[model samples]
Target chain A: MELTRHYLIRRFREYYHKAKIYEPIEFRMREWAFVPLKNFPDFVMVRHVSFSEMEELREFLISNVPAHVYFSSAYYLKPSAEMDEKGWTGADLIFDIDYDHLPTKSLESAKREVFKLLRILEKDFGIDEKEIEVCFSGNRGYHVHVYDERFRELGNMERREIVDYLTLRGFKLKGTQFDRVCKIIHRYVRDGKVNVDEKTGEILRSSLNEIRKGRLDLIPPEVREELIERCLKKLVVHVDPPVTADVKRLIRLPNSLHGKTGFRVVLIDLNDLESFNPYVDAVAFGDESVKVRLLKKVRVNFGGERYILERGRHSLPEYLAVFLMCRGVALYGH
Target chain B: MRRPFLPILPYLERYPFLKIGSKLFKFSKDEVLSNVEKARDFVEKVLEDKVEFDFKPIDFLCSNCGIREECEGYEGCSYNISSAEYHLKLSRAKKAVLNWLRCKVVVSNLDEFLRRRFAVKLARLYRDLILKECDDFILFMADDFGLNHEGFSIHVADYLKYAVRMKSDDWKLVNRFLSKGYVDLSRNEFVRLMEKVIKEILMEKVQINLNVRLKVDFKRKELERLPLKVECFPECMKSILSDLNEGKNVPHTGRFAIASFLINIGYDVENVVDVFRNAPDFDEDKTRYQVEHIAGLRGKGERYVAPSCETMKSWGLCVWSCEVDHPIKFYRRCLSGGDKGKRSSKRKGDSQDYA
Candidate 1:
């Protein structure tokens, strides 16, 4: 697999200005880090830039086009050269819903998992939808950012508790204390009366009992247990553990180009997530054809289209060629 | 020129029991703001002079301290200035602030626009003055509200309804505090703001009150009480009672479950106390008070419910599938003269309930 440096450099110069870098409200008060070059691979940290100097930072990106760009989730007061020296401020609670953590391998399955987590965050924790920001990671997953101020102040232990609640870990089936009567057959119970047999005068157990003809003399004892088991099943939402637990961890910048996928890190509308196809929506390049040489036979399924390539020169769409080159499976041909 | 402690005055009059030390104080918005200002001045004064509260214990007063019985020279004497003088002062300050919040402070006299405007200014002042030094307190308060625990203590939610007769009445205000955006207050923003300010002003000693006492043991004695039937008890309850009867140590959850279970089944506080008398570490007064608290005869007048089947399962105390949803349901059947020997027959056709 080969990738031409000149092609990447030229592409970065052309489209780097258009790339969007997510900045905290206090941008200057954060520690920024970036991969200077693909060959170097090491992330050079301890960089700081004010809002006014964003243009200079953009120009630097145009010149170098770092392999990856990241700003600390944390807002620091000192933001020194060493991490320990920096005074910690609060951060946005970001959940990395990667495909690997999901029960199924498909992106569709990952989306379902992400939605389940979103539901738990909303219904259980009462976090508002507007406070949550969803971003496609431009590779293999989604990044959900909860910008709610309440979550920002949560420590690692508290954040782990949220993860525990989501995953249903440490959830005891017998410990659930509900003051209200169980809802399962309560709907059928009208005016404090259960359907009863007239002749023998026995109270019939309603919908919750399988005994259609037999009289339910008492409230079923297992009604609460059954409801709890169902609740436990619904509560088990899979999430990438490390991502939620790390309060100070840096995340992929939203709307910025992912160096590995050659696709833009796209911001998704929570209401429109069902229709959001990352490959189609996040293509940063035009459809003009470009010549590329595949180092090996490559089969790519992107957007709605699929392509099979042999180890030879082929004229492909500009976006597909760039994607292949970025993936390091093809080279720019003269 | 200031609002006449309008919102909180009624609350203080209603709940005379909400005393901050010797004084049953009526705390207002102005009082809270003024306290913040005072605490700021105190912080600066103490920081400048380095006049710190000494945590060291004085050896002579160890016998007279209220907590000396439990202290046993192991957890150190509680006779220090921090606990004696400053701790009381802190507890009072905390109660004042908590009472201020407990009384919903929306004013009819002030203009709606001015109210929000003043609220924003106050929120910002609290954020700047209090948040920097007392972040841990704020975090603790948040957790204290958010997490549910098995105990006979007053939760933040309980305090929110300081004078409210019913949970539903207080829940209406809580729902408003948490519901969709209230003009300038965007969803739970107000709650978060109030929590931070309250935490900053509140002293750590009074943040959680777990002390329980029996106020009406006579009234409790008049109520019809039943003998605890161990044979008919749920597995979890039976296990806890067995542990206590054998003078074996049980966890707090177990104690809570047992206390809640016995009380819910119409057993009086004294009977419940007798059940725990054999426990190795049982204290008669403490056990009686805790039992009274769980029986809803003391403290907040709210009886503790037995931990649900799910809670027992989580605690790893749920041993058998009794096919009952709640421990209370099992106990209710036994207490109501339902056939205990014929209980197994009730489980025969209940496939869907088990499913």
Candidate 2:
């Protein structure tokens, strides 16, 4: 049987009341939007809030639980006003790395990709360890927030440039000094401006030319092909560019329960990011068994475990039951 | 005995020529043959530091002197020297240092070149001795030498100076440090320093997670002016740009569609690449190469065409219908005239051609 919207909202409120909510930096200045179950998804009410006002907001949520909760990445003097009139201040640099956005079939690789982007920010950009924050989306993604004071006022073009650098967009091999060395040694260009043999005269041009022509047999023992390969590999990182570029974006509020998954969007430490499994770690409901009627044959991976469902009645953990019911695919009291 | 006025050895060595009243001459024993023995004995005693000699009335060249710019004299001129000579020396020093760092010089003669060349030795003088011995010379060099002029030459000396300037504001201390001399470092150590400095500079250039927006409004006004909006875009390409702009990772195929469509529509490679800046793992060189490849600027000279509307529909990328068989046709029609000829026979002809 399908749970009534009222029952779903009530359970969500209970989960919210029991869970420990994360406090985002400068939480008081953020704009919040709530979509109620009674209205269309597009219909949302926005409000400006401070940390001190969170208790009242929580009380409102508990009374009439929203279907979805979203917070602006931007800060404003007066939020919930007309777009042109709101006294917008600044925003945090947020990155949303979603598994569904990538073509990878397994969630494992997608999570690895997220780590890869984060590592670039840490190692290449030299961002301080504490300045970067990672969190689970409570569904199929990771969100990274950068709260460095230096980045607050960057415009979209500058943000886009950062994204370009990270993603290797418009990066030219011809412009790189290392690649120029490789090209000169291998005679890829006819310009005599680059004379590499003067240093290591042992590198004969005939052999280099043969190697350049794809005749690997003519490769000299002194030539380290790996050097060129390594330089080439250093050129690019695959990432979603728009996240860094969009200044006025909305992000799912941390510590809020996801409407569909019945999972909590929790902040995760960078050290613990690799081992974080959203299905297991973010489950908001208790382990009480509940009877749910499956609407169709489906497979799900949740809470670090997999479940296969057939088109029939089945007993599931309370969180999974709520997840399916909220997804509108199963009836909990059939 | 006719006493010859013998000059101070340190001052003489720094300025080998002596001004006899108005005319400057090399300090030769022939000029004062009557007291040659006395001069020789005075020079020997002065060299041995056994006797202190008084400084001669030296004539320093002024900047206005004709010989100042071109003079290669070993010591101070009879007239005041021009800053142009100092600038020339500094420029050469920067070039020599950069050349050595870039491995442009013959490895065997590097030490000899460094010691003999004015360019190389002058750099050493500033970096090791002059800055400590005299503040005026360092000030002179600093005023004459420019960081902007050193093109394509990466030297640790300049990099260190830049780093120091970036860190501290005390010019006196910085000048003192420069004069006190850099530690004797191996060639490889210098190279490593240059590499580290370059990497730091690159990191600064590639700033990450700056919460800034584009000052140049990203809205393509021309695109907006077209009769067709994003609704005309194949769902795949539209979603790809949206996802990229929103910082959501997109499938490779989605990226390919956007790139191909943008390239086909005559968007510059940089603009096309800008669209992908929000991609999760972006690399400028790689994206440029990829976009260039799709644009037929790289690879085997074959420009990639955007996938057909029917193919996009098959891939579930077509969420709306415009009755056009191809994406290019839709875009073309949109650019030409939007909705005015919605029921035109031109679309019918395109449908029949595909059918």
Candidate 3:
């Protein structure tokens, strides 16, 4: 089902011709990179590219029609120079919540994780709701960026702590700080909020008095661990570590089309995120009929349509056809 | 302040103190000359003391950790700090003398090295005194940062300046008492960061002269001379070398690490190039140029060292858990022909000024 490089490039060009790709915030201060749609599933990014004017980025997008467009999260004095030569001014603190990295690997899980992350950022980190910019990655995750000047100059170690805070990595529930974790476990065990086997549940039920008193050892170690794990699961926010830690990371640009699924990398307000549907809302192509040879059986479920297709030549709406073709599950011009 | 004398100082930040001694510390010629002798005596006394520091949690519910609910630390401050303040200031005055010495002059890496050790030693004493006096001083410092201590937490934004500087995993926010809108700290946590801040500030001011000679003879033993021994190579390095010698397409990190290690271990560019002869895509000109570049001949002209053991582990180059912090440490162990050999080289003499 691998599409030819020429096919993807040609298809990508058509989308860019009318894509209306917009620049990221602080466009002139950031470095840009592009990995052209070629050699399916493999790409070498061309970076250290910048633009002084609006027309340059626009013209370049039209000419290049990059498969995956990215811009540095950091602001640099010389955006097009070598890494060491480019003076580092500041960077946006980024958090990535990819569904693939989650235990369930479901979009529903990713949404829940993003909510947990937002809560921690808003609550623990005290980052304002308005200051947090959440964007659909146009693929499998959400990219949350904080452009607050206070958080910008945080070095790698500081960001490492922030990530560790979100994930609760190496957090121990035994000493001076264990009181909070004990409280969390107590509520879960006492209220039967934890999911465990009947015997473990019975143990938790039997140890209600001890649990209420924050004495976890009154129950079996297995049940104790299970309760603690499940309780903390609600508290831990799953984020891709490197995306947040790496100051120089080049993130997929908003408003640019994700070359893989031919969807727009769009931003969503915090209020609207609950109902945000990437497949439906992120679709950039219109419903003009187009010919495509389906090489693999696949399902198209969003954008107010559902089609379980077979392997054959079929005339589909341009929106559906482009998605299938760009995903490399089909070929153009049946 | 009194301490045992250091034989020879360790390698420390030398440039700031030596290169800009007078301008940095803002001392006049007479003031610098006279105080240098006084500062040397003060440093000798300060270095003579054995500083013992330990933080054991007392399990007592402490307040003023910027958190209101609860905190971990020793007993809370229960007494008036009128004398405590005087005691703290006395230490500060003594430390200021050493601070001036640290900033004013450093022979090679001499004073620079001693300053770092002095700061930490003094800081440990400072932290204990602060704890004994009560968290009032700690709270006072936090207030300077606009950090408000409430029920077992401080707002993350308010405390990041101090917390961000904490390197240990135990000091990570995850290990702290976390609540909605706050990160909790114990008494020890506050004092630890406060101590580090004291140490950093301690190194910022000092007095000494640009033209002075020490009547001390000491080998530069801090910069260890390691022999070119392949057998002494750590497993991580050995694997990379063998891979290149076997015409394998080693990862970029592996190649850089091996090349840096070879260059650091006294391999000539031509000799290193010969090792890469069997590389998958070996090109003589490119290999030689890269080797030369790593040897600090071209571009930045900064010689590269092999990545540390932690970095090696991160890069997945480590084949086994080598009991050393760096590949070079492993090599040193091999050369010593033991598991871990210790060395002590000390040279002590009074530094005299010559007109």
Every model's DockQ: 0.01, 0.01, 0.32
Chain B fold agreement for model 2, TM-score: 0.31
Each candidate structure's TM-score, on Cα atoms with residue i matched to residue i, is: 0.47, 0.45, 0.68
Candidate rank order under DockQ: 3, 1, 2
Angstrom error of the Cα, residue A289, model 2: value is 1.1
Which docking category, incorrect, acceptable, medium or high, applies to candidate 3? acceptable
What stretches of model 3 exceed 4 Å from their correct place?
A1-26, A36-44, A52-56, A59-64, A174-184, A191-214, A229-236, A293-312, A329-331, B1-115, B128-136, B142-169, B180-182, B202-355
What is each predicted model's overall lDDT from 0 to 1? 0.56, 0.54, 0.67
Q: What is the Å distance of residue A35 in model 3 from its true position?
A: 3.3
RMSD of 1: 20.1
Cα deviation at B186, candidate 1, in Å, is 26
TM-scores of chain B alone in all candidate structures, in the order given: 0.36, 0.31, 0.50
Q: Model 1, A1-334: lDDT tens per residue? A: 2246567667755777776756555666666666654452234543543233667668767766776667777777765446545777777788888888665776777788789878756754557898898888888888898887755766554575556556655443211111112242343343334433442223433343432222222444464345445545544677787688777788777777777777888889998898888877888888889888888999998865778788889888888888888787888884
Between candidates 1 and 3, name the one with more favorable DockQ.
3
Give the fraction of native contacts in model 3.
0.48
lDDT of 1 at B231: 72
iRMSD of all candidate structures? 11.1, 15.8, 4.2
Query: In model 3, how large is the Cα lDDT of residue A149?
Result: 68
Q: What are the per-residue Cα lDDT tens digits for candidate 3 across B1-355? A: 1111110011011111222222223434554355465544434444455434343422122333344333222223222235555355434433454445533354213455566555666666767755763344346455443455563256664456567655455666776655654666777776676676666655554343354344433233443245676777776777888888778899878888988887776777887888888888989998887888788777445576677766676677876555466777777777777534222211112212111
Q: lDDT by residue for model 1 over B1-355, one digit each (tens)?
A: 1222222222222221223222424455455433333333333332233333322222223324475455534123333453345445445445644434432222112233332333344444443432332333333333434432112122222222221222232222222222121212322333444433343233112221222221212122311245556677776777888888899999877898888887877777887899888889989998887788787676435577677776787677776566666787776566566666335534323545445
Instruction: Give each candidate's fraction of reference contacts reproduced.
Output: 0.00, 0.00, 0.48
